[model samples]
Target: MATRISSSFRGLILLSFFAYLCLCAHEAEETTETQHHHQISHTIPVISLIPSNACTSSAKGSERKASLEVIHKYGPCFQSKNYDEKVPNHLEILLQDQARVNSIHSRLSKEYSDNNKSRDSQVATLPATSGLPIGTGNYIVTVGLGTPKNDLKLIFDTGSDLTWTQCEPCARSCYSQVDPIFDPSKSTSYSKISCNSSECSQLISATGKPTTLLLYLRLRIRYKYGDGSFTIGDFSKDRLTITTEDVLDNFLFGCGQDNEGLFKGAAGLLGLGRNQISIVKQAAQKYGQFFSYCLPSTSDSKGHLTFGNGGVSSTVKFTALQTLSQSQSFYGLDLIGLSVGGTQLSIPKSAFSQEPSSIPARLSKVCLAFAGNRNETSIGIIGNTQQRELEVVYDVAGERIGFGKGGCR
Candidate 1:
């Protein structure tokens, strides 16, 4: 009995010692991680762009006009129209949302397909579209570029990576824009990249096309939209002014010499994709691979785009981001179960699977599968449907996305 008691005491002591060692190691690891995060935060700069005054100056007027137009064209229950039909005023605006969702789905599917295939295999061409619309949506931001600072109102797009605007010396092609076209020659900071440059190499890798020699030293890039709109221009770098006080120099963007299709009153696109050249990726040093936006439902209302960790709220419920091997530019989420009212739906987990080739069609119906309130205005489509209801948070650092109700409202 005495020997048995002594053995039990020894076992307890050994366990306690091991626990202490584990606790100490965990604490040390946490401390190191905290210090590394601190260092990163100090190094990267944060940029926040709000809905510009120009966008909100006549908010009521625009909202009323937009609402009236939507009701007249699509009525209470919006239905998809034929391509040949003249673009309705409100439908044109809403089409931006549709285009964005489609672009994201296409890119993600392509990325997934590429990853599953073996190396040295020819990549299949996926039908991808540029999300650019003829005019600006309610979520517009004023961006200043060049030496004297040419402020241009641009549509903020998370689905794309290349930021571009119509430029002067438009001998080739230029659309009638509300704002003045950007002239690279006027800006002392403007410089065209060469085909042999590393930046051009990266562009080639992304688009799978060689850089075209447009002018004497200008390297050209062709951007094709899913809607058949395409822009061909010089890929150059210049200073971009986000706010009155904050300016990002040598910002890489396309100087569109020849632009066509429906790019209405807006000047260009502000890309916030996951690529290295995207606004999010370029500012990763400051934002730490994270950004969030709250898209407003009304045309008159304003939405915000925040960089880094400032936008995440404590109330948001997060789900792990679905990581794909090929497409790092998209934020994919795994949706296990969906609920309607108090009862969970009987939908299969595989129904929401994003298997690249099967996702685009499955995603459109995933929302409908719940059979919730059919009268709900936001349904059928992915972008406007989900965004209008939930305050979607992209936690890039954590590799997760958080969805919460009433945050946007």
Candidate 2:
């Protein structure tokens, strides 16, 4: 009896030893993954805390305000316009986004150096597809561009300072777009800015390229993006109608006669950068320099871009904007840390960097949306995934940015 009991006890002990080994091995695998994410960029993690019935969660205490319908290029709105979504190569997208980041850094650096030397200089995505979106895409909004109102769909960009579109009589070459190239001549409100005007000289700081006289009166300007795409055209102003109640006149914009870039069938860009040239600066008096936008977390849901503070909810959280550079053209946020599965990541604060930089990871497989910039000294962009399903509000007058959840509903 004693011998039998000893044999059973020894067998039980052996079993426990194996189980312990298995647990250690499993933990190592997990450590490897966590380390992978940690090592990739030394950043942290952000998990979606979206509650069920997100619409109720999103709208509780928040007013449903509308101004411009912000749509994904691959969403139903663009498809209804007969514009096909651009096929995305994820690796390529990352590379190009990095290029764009590089361009922005270069522009900001030059602007900063010029300021220290004499002051003032110049500067510088898609997620929709097959249920597989890029971290973000060129979000578009429609607005009227002249008398008789040529309603144009523009890629509303907070990173860019000049609102521009392809114009009629493509003086050089223009990319094909869904809307008819804006016929500036047909618009009674359209007027070309002269080379000698103060506004024309402002283009020097805006585009980071000096204005040149194509003729004694014509101010021809060229603006290049980090993706190696560019626009060379006339700098002009026209009446910009955002909504029936929110019309802005004398809105300076680019009439791209020689526009080259993959805009994915949108008419052009709407600049909302942090300078006097941005629409935010141009329309500050009417709207109080306040605007907010929500990118839908899913394709079926809707997102919006409104120009007032009427929709702010009580639950919204605000983060102070950090000046990562001298130009201050883009929205800056200090992403001090990240967390995973409710645990804060143990890493340096220097890791967090740009637009909504992540996607919800899948089960049993982790693919981080963060990428390392060219160098650690590079400026960071507000990560797109970081803003997923949240309302991003810009209070330029307040000099602080805010976010509210449940916005996609």
Cα lDDT listed for each candidate: 0.49, 0.57
TM-scores, in order shown? 0.62, 0.72
Best by lDDT: 2
User: What overall lDDT, based on C-alpha atoms, would model 2 receive against the true structure?
Assistant: 0.57
User: What TM-score does prediction 1 earn?
Assistant: 0.62
lDDT of 2 by residue, 118-214 (tens): 3322222110101012223346678999997999988776766677888987887887677888999999999998877788766655544433332
After superposition, the stretches of candidate 1 with alpha carbons farther than 4 Å from their true spots are: 1-138, 210-217, 348-381, 405-409
Q: List clash counts for every candidate, in order.
A: 9, 18
lDDT of 1 by residue, 110-160 (tens): 656765664431211222345454433334556789998997866665545
